[model samples]
Each structure stands twice: as structure tokens, then as C-alpha cells.
Target chain A: MPDTAFADPDAGLSPAELAARHGLGFAGTRPTLGGYARQLWAYRHFIVAYSNARVSASFSLTRLGRLWQVLTPLTNAAVYYLIFGVVLATRHSTPNFIAYLCTGLFIFVFTQTVAQAGVASITGNMGLIRALHFPRACLPIAIALIELQNIGASMLVLTGIVLLTGEPLTWEWLLIFPALALQMIFNTGLGMFLARLGSKMTDLKQVIPFVMRTWMYGSGVFYASSLFAEHLPRWAAVIVEANPMLVYIELIRHAMLENVKLSSTLPHLWLLAVVWALVVFVGGYVYFWRGEQEYGRG
Target chain B: MGVAEVAERPAEAGQRIPTVIVDDVHVVYRVQGPGTPGSGSPVAALSRMLTGKRTPGLREVHAIKGVSFTAYRGEAIGLIGSNGSGKSTILRAIAGLLPIEKGGLYTAGQPSLLGVNAALMNDLSGERNVELGCLAMGMSKADAKKNSPSIIEFSGINERGDFASLPMRTYSSGMAARLRFAIAAAKKHDVLLIDEALATGDARFRKRSEARVRELRAEAGTVFLVSHNNQSIIDTCERAIWLESGEIRGDGPTADVIKEYQQYMNRK
Candidate 1:
């Protein structure tokens, strides 16, 4: 037997040391940030494909097919207009009420859908997480992409409504590109952050819709956010103006409407948009990456 | 041959590069259920509340006891165990799908787990799923697009009709399982852990998949197949590990370990 006990080569070393010596890495440990970014980059195509698949699959069973994508938000805008515009008579406070409402609704809906999807991304795709070896961030990233496409559809309807409401097309309207891009980044980050949280406490999934509704109410999606200064305390209005959803909505409103005025306290909407995108995206990504190995475990 | 000899024998035959090294790994699952103490009845809940006992329904299950093994390149190993014996749990641990509470699992490359019930996207078409699966496995867009047709063809889902166009939910379970195995097998993995995916396929598909597994081994990949079908194990794997109650009972040549497992089961 050649003295089996003495012959055992790795007997003296701890498992971690043994693995290190043999050039084996701890299988489920999170990769370094650069390495993780590279992995995410490599799977970029997967993100696109998965998001596309999800978008198509969502409406594949319906007779209207992808038209539901536009119809959903259109119907939602109509219902909100009926209640908030007709019933509450809030239209007198805002200029070009239809354009303003649609812009805010579309922008707020973008974040709302992204948040809801992000929260469910990990918990909803347990099978995919357990089956394949990939970056778990892909789920939320894909969710973000799906919502971007949804917003793209909604933007078309928003543009048509704005033009119908007699808002002129101008050079400033091109700012929508940067504004949308920043919002996408912010939404993606938030989704990723929520994906990790949702995977841990699936109960959060049930509570998310109510939270989103409350967020929408506070975001000035229907009523003018300027009214906050007139109604609420100065600190509260400033806090509400600083909300990420409000920042994004205000940015989109500025891009699409000529008459919409920038918030006086935070005249730099673009600056806030950029800062929110960078902070949330980086923070949410790290949070999600920290829980990389825990996503699929029971 | 002895257990040590079995692992070393392959080293002598080939390079014996270790692909997966699982060292004394432990996994515990904290599950909440109705049967757990102070969970079901209102009186129990009240008493537990009065006592301030946290997580009333939570029960800790030591799913994988301290288990250790090493898998080498170019080897096909079968894990034979009765239900609840931690076969799937160990596989998930190696695949990095589950967290380990103790010890360590080290691998040279990513370990992909092919479980029977892992439906990628039930509402997406099978063809779309193949593309997405390839992309998800880190294949580039062009490569995924290029290889998807062949993968779908390999699964034989389109043999009867253009079934690949239909949503995965429309396919039979066996068809879906076959498609999943085909997508997984299309990629060359350093360590592939399969959990009863083959048993869902027909006999002809099983034979084809077994042959594909050998080809994967020949490509210097380590494949661990967990199945109740001993004959498949005997045909596909040279080494087998017999597990019972979260611990390894026998580990050696397929025939020897399987014989021991059979003897133990029959005795019971």
C-alpha cells in the first residue's frame, strides 16, 4: 500500500490552503468587481435575448399581441385622467394637461414596472438561477431592459399625445435620450437591489405594488409637484422634489414640454438625474453582487 | 480496488487534473412547515409568542453531512442514492447554486447543474429558449444564434413536427426535459452535474445522451450524473459513489459500489 497515511499529499493542509495550492477557487465565492463586470459584459447578449423573450412571451397569448404594450399604458392613462383629471379637477393647475399627465405617467410607469419586475426577478426565476451558472444580476438587468422596451412603446404614445396637445417639436426634445438613459441606469440599479432583497424575503413581493402606488402618488405623476411647496412644509416639499422618481419625471417633462417649469430649489434636474443614476446603479449592483451565491439556495 | 486506489488509478492513466474538489462540505436547510413545533395550532402560537420564541415554524435540516470527494477531468462519475440522501444537494453545492455551511467546494471552472425540473422560460418557444440558454451559458450572440438550431435538432423536439416553435409549456414534460438536457450538453463544461434529466427521455434518447456524455468526458470534462437507474450508471460511469442519509456509504468502481448499494437496499 506504500504507507497510505504518509502518502496522502494534501493531508497536512487545510481545505482552503489545499484549494489555493492546487489553483482551485472556492466555487461559489463572489468574483472581484472587475471580473464580475467582465462576466456581465460577456453575458450582455443573454440579457438582451432574455429581455426580448420575456417581452414577447408576456403578450404572446393575447389576440392583440404586442399592441397590449401600448394599450396597457394608454388605458391606464385614460383611467387616471378620468379620476384625477375629471373627478378631482386637477387639470386647471397644469398647462397642456394631457401632455403633462402622459409624460409623467409614462416616466413614473417606467420606474414602477422596473421596480416591480426587479423585486420579482430573482424569486421568479428560481429555475433559471438553479439550472445555469451565470451572473444572477442578469435577471434584474434583463428586467430593466424589458421595461426600457415598454417605455419605448409608451414614449411613442406620449409623443403623439403631446403633439396632439399642440406642444411643438424642438431641439430640447432630443434631451429625452440622455434623460431616458439615466433613468434606465437608475431603474436597473434599483431593480438589482430589489432582486436581491426579494429573493431573500419573497413576502416583499406582495407588498411592492402598494409601495409603488404610494410612490406614484408622492411623485407628482398626476398633480403638479410644485403644489407640494404651496401645500406641504418647505422641508417636505424639498424632500419630495429630491425623490428619484420625481427627478426622472421632471426630466422627461422638461424634455417633452416647452411650458413645464424646472423645480426652483433644484434647477439642475440633469445633475440630479446623473447623480441618482450613478449612485443607485453602483450601490444596487454591489448589493446584488454581495449576495451572488445565496440567490438560489433554499 | 480500494477507494483511494480508484481515484489515483485515473491519475496514472491520464493527467488526472482535479476539476471539482468538495472537502467535508455541510449544507443545512432552514425550512418552515405546518408540522414544525409551535406552528400549527393557535394555542401553540400563543404560547410561543408568550415565550418569545423566534421563527416558530423554522426547522433546521442537515441535508448534507460532512461529505468529501474529488472529481477528476475525463471521468464520468455516477451518484447513486435513495431519495432524500442528499444527492441533489451535493450536486447543487458543487454547481454553486447552494451555499455550503462548512468546509469548501473548489472547482477549476463553472459547474452547470442540469436538473429535471429546470424550465428556463415556460412561456417562451423552445427555439427561443435554446438561444437564451446558450447565451446564458456565456456563449456570444453569434455563437448562440449559430448553435441553437443544432441544439434543438439534437433534442429531437422537431422530429415529429415544428414543435420547437411552440412554447415550452405546450410540450410534454419529457420533451421539455430532453430539450433542457440538449441545451446543457451542447456546451462543454468543466464539471456538469445532471440530476435525473436522462430518465425523463425515451430509451433511444437515453442511449444518445449517454453517448454524448462519453464524448464530453473525452473532451476532458468531469461529469457527475445522479440517477436511480443503476444500469445507466453502469453503462455511463466507471466510478460511482453510493450515498445514504447524507453520507457516502461506498465509493469506488461502478460495479462494486452499485453492488454494495443493492445489497444494503435489499437487506433493508
Candidate 2:
């Protein structure tokens, strides 16, 4: 498919001979994505470095600088709470609904940010990708670093949420951090998938807002997953419980919420998170690599 | 008339021993129709796709077609052609940006297409793009930091002194182009592709840049340059390829190809 790969010159391309010249940080090859994964990890430094530049520069001109990172989300959560907490007064079985909503919303926002940006990642960075010879995966991973910057501020915001709610913590609270990390890995993988899809068909860009909105609501950000316990069928219930985000948010509240129960879904949640991460991480990676030669043509 | 003939030939050749082989790399693209101002419905995209009326937006244009060449270690090749004659396309394809359909392209080193691709950010200071460029070129962070000062000085932008900190966007087009050329030229690669960007800088910078290209060649690097300025190509390149309609009409001594190309132009 030389013609096929090269067919779309103005759009969709891998780096021009990037793997040939720079070696994408691997020697030899394997049948699967082991090569690509290792390459992504090796390119992690590039991701961090570039991400630092983008995040800092993106905010540099403003008066507040990095404070905008914290402020933007803090404001977003405040806006949501004022509407949902005070105006709507949506009560829940889960006490301290403010913290519950904030915790779930913050993590859910991470997934949304990555998804919104991820689809356009490779396509948008066409200029950088074309000129410089490096791993294609670095584009998506680099974007994650932007979210990682948000993590620090968001965590601070979360801790503040906890303080306001007065939720006691146990050792299980420690799991929140790792859960956040796993969620990020999952997000990165999904980002990779989106990068590939977005590069292929820009319609993904159009569909993204609707998709993220659906995901946000279904993720139980407003109330609790427990709200759906009666209406959803057994399989549907199982499916929602299996959502990696649900697991993390539920786990977060269990750890932080005042006297919340640890759902039997913990092992299932951990398994689901790992599997989702690896599946998207590895699956999206393989799909993206199969188009390696295609990236240069675009 | 049959593109299939040329496209099929490469498959018959050796499949996977890469020195720098591009076989029959043909890059064809579709012109997406301009969105018609329709009755305001979001389904306009679907409706457009459903229309089977495919008008060739323009004629089928060939950027690079059936162009074949081989370069060994230590060989410097020049590509000379009329505007839109596919000289830059050839370089981009060799750099793996375009695909060819009618021939084979082989080179030893991964090419850095050093013209349009060589450009740096104008929003940030020249220094930032330099760091980004060096890193993008795959230099380690420490190495990029180490080499950045030398690259800046090598670019002669530092001689402009403190004004260099001003965003490149503020600089004249010439200044921005010169900084880009100097920085891309700063790093040496086994294979380099030079587009016409070198003509932007002052005389002294051009001479220094020429010497750098020569030095890279002396170090056994392969260089492919695309330029309309015949004098520079003849002066710098021992060999040249003349392209017409994305086809290499002539490939041999720089003088032979340039002379033939000139004759074709004069006759027309």
C-alpha cells in the first residue's frame, strides 16, 4: 500500500524516516508492541521535556502563570458545585456530596481533557512530527505530561475538598494516588487510540464533545453510582461497576468518604483498570504502529 | 498511461534491505471539496459524502513520480528543477514525507530535509526553538543544552546581542529564515537535504553555511540540495538530477543536468 500510505499527502503522516534515522530507541524487533512500548518509555523524557515547555509557555503570558492551571479547575469545580450543590441541592446517600462530587469530577475531568486533546495530538503536531525524527507515540505521551501538571493542582484541590467534607481517611486512602496513576496510564492509552483515530478521520474531533459528555454523566459525577443500583439491569450494573473510572471514584470515596463501604468490586476494579490500561495502552499502540509508515505521508 | 507498470516494478525488487531504498513511492491525494453553504443542518457532511459526484477538483497533479536515484556514503547530490518541477518533492520523499510510484530511491543515512522542515518556532525566542529543534533532532537534554550556545553563536544571531531575546515573530522574515537555516545547519547528520532556504541569509552566513556543508561532506556525509539558484548548485554539488513533472529527466554531472534544464526552459 505504498500508494495508499502516500495517498494522503496533506493529512495523516508518520515522521519522515524517523525510525530509520533515530531508531525510535530500540534495536531489533518483536512481533508485538513490546518494541513500541519500550520506545514510548524511552521517549518519556522527550514527552516530559516538551510537556514542560508547552504547559509553562501556554500559561507564561498570563498574570497568574501556573496558578491558572489550579485556578481553571478550581473554578470549574466551584461552578459545578454551586449549581449542583446549592442551587440544585441534589442530595445523595453518600454524605458530604461536595467532596464526593469534586473527587469524582476531578478524575473524570482528567479523562475528558486527554480525550479532547488526544484525538488531535498527532494530527495537530504535524509540523513538529514532520521535521523532527522521533517516535510517533511521544506526541500522545507528551500530552499526558500536561495533565500530570494538572495533577498536582488538582490533588491540592482534592485535599481541600476532603477538608471541607471532613471525611476521615484510612490506609485505603493511600490507594487513591496509585489509582490516579493507573487512571493516567489508561488515559494515555486511550489518548493513543484517539491520536490514531483523529489522524485518520477528523470526524472524531466532531464527535468528541458529545462522547465526553455522555461519559461524564454516566460516570456518576453528579450523584453516586449507587443511584443507578435499582434502574440498571444486572449486566448494565456490572458494566457500570466495571468502568475503570467508577472503580477509582468509588474507591476514592471509600477511602475518603465518612464511613463509606468498600464495594466487593475492588479486585474487579483493579483488574479492570490494569486490563483497560494494558488493552488501550497496548492495543492502541499496536494499531498506531501498524500505521507507522502512514504517518510520514500525511 | 499505466501507473501500474511503474508501481509494480518495485514489488519485484528486493523487499527489505534498507540502506535508503524508496521504491516506486507515489504520493496521490484527494482534494476535499470546499464545504458548500447549505441549509443549516449538521448532516451536511453526511450529505456531501453521499453525493457520488466526484469531480476532479483540478487535474491529477503529480508532485514526484517515477524519480529514481541512489547515493552512497560521501556523495553529495543536487536536485535542480523549475518551480513545481518536483525538486523539493524529491527531497521530502527521500526524507520519507512523500511516497513515489514509478522508481526506487536509496540513500545511506536518514535524511534531514533542511529547508521547510528546518524552520523553527517564531513565537518563542530563537533560543527556545533552538532547544526544541535540537531535542527534536533526538539530542539528549544535556547535549541540547550543551550545544545550544554554540549553535546560537554559530548562527551569528548572538552577534545581534540582546535583541535575540525578542520573539522571532517580531523579526523580519529574512532574520527569522536566517536563524532557522543556521540552527538546522548547526547539527550535522549523515544525510542532509537542503531546500532553497539558504538564500535568505546574508553573504557571510551563506559562505559559512556552504563551508559547513562541505565539511559535512568531507566527513563522509551525503547531501541532497534543492535550489533554483544554479550557481549555488553547480558550485556545491558534483552531481545533479533534473526533474520534470516529478520525473527525473536527467541524472549525471551537475553541469550536464543544469545545462539541459536551462535549454528546456529557454526553448519553452
RMSD of each: 2.9, 7.7
lDDT of 2 by residue, B229-250 (tens): 8888988887777777776677
- Per DockQ, the best of the predicted structures is 1
lDDT of 1 by residue, B40-138 (tens): 788886787799886556678999998887777777899998999999999988989888999888998788899997768888889899998888888
The docking category that best describes candidate 2 is incorrect
Candidate 1 wrongly placed segments (more than 4 Å):
A1-18, A265-267, B1-15, B32-53
For model 2, the stretches where C-alpha displacement exceeds 4 angstroms are A1-32, A261-264, B1-23, B30-44, B48-61, B99-104, B117-119, B163-166
lDDT of 2 at A258: 70
Q: Residue B96 of model 1: what lDDT?
A: 90
Candidate 1 lDDT, A7-53, residue by residue in tens: 14656666567667668888888899889999999888888898899
* Error of model 1, residue B265, in angstroms: 1.2
DockQ of candidate 1 (2 decimals): 0.55
Q: Using Cα atoms with residue i matched to residue i, what is each candidate's TM-score against the true structure?
A: 0.93, 0.85
